[model samples]
Target: MFESIKRDLSFIQGLLEGDVNHQHHVEYRGLSRLVDVVDLLVESVEQLERRLSELEEYVETIDEDLNELELLCYDDDEEDDEWDHEIEVTCPECGEDVTIDEDDLDDENVELLCPKCHTVLDLEEIDEEDVETVISED
Candidate 1:
């Protein structure tokens, strides 16, 4: 790719200096038309590079998200894999739902408090119905 880019740049510079050859008349009009063609190629190459860069960034983001998701709690104890593992953030005292995820239950000892009512809810506090609803939306 770098070699190709360098060759294109060299071609552009040659065109700019009007050192390129043509079969017919060697007029400025013909060179100008050829420059326009090069300009289009350069613009297209730039656009493709930008798109590839964006795709790379998207892949990186997905990788990071996957890393975070892997840390989510998986159930091997009382509950089955399908519905046993989940994270729950809620008002512990009031039972109001806040944020829920599979990672919430990763550690049973951890307790998260709700911002609304200041209630402490742990991974066990989260309900299966809440998990079902949240998973459906995701």
Candidate 2:
């Protein structure tokens, strides 16, 4: 599209250049001014086309980056879904195994009181792999 416009502008510049040198003094002056204006307009349009192309490439890059960011942010549902509702842990105080529901867990660190002997258990202190092993075995 831009190439077509540039070709048309070049044709007009050639015609104006010829008309500017004609013998009619008054008409020649008007044609000369028109030629200068046309040249400036063509140069401005070319610059605009260049800038628009750059902007298009920039927008495409941003779109790709946003797609990657979306995958990183929300693509872990499968991994998260592997864990079951209940997590089994061994109480350190009473040495009794206990099953706790994941839904009952709070946001902050809290005690997992064992029902067998009322032993206070710190869930974070237990290795996650051990808990996963027990849960998976069950």
lDDT of 2 by residue, 26-124 (tens): 776776677677667878988998999999999999999999988887678655667656777777777687887766455355667889899777766
How close to the true structure is residue 100 of candidate 1, measured as C-alpha lDDT? 54
Local distance difference test, per candidate? 0.63, 0.72
Return the TM-score for candidate 2, rounded to 2 decimals: 0.45
Model 2 CA deviation exceeding 4 Å by range: 1-24, 77-138
What is the model-wide C-alpha lDDT for candidate 2?
A: 0.72
Query: At residue 96, what lDDT does model 1 achieve?
Result: 67
Evaluated with lDDT, which candidate comes out highest?
2
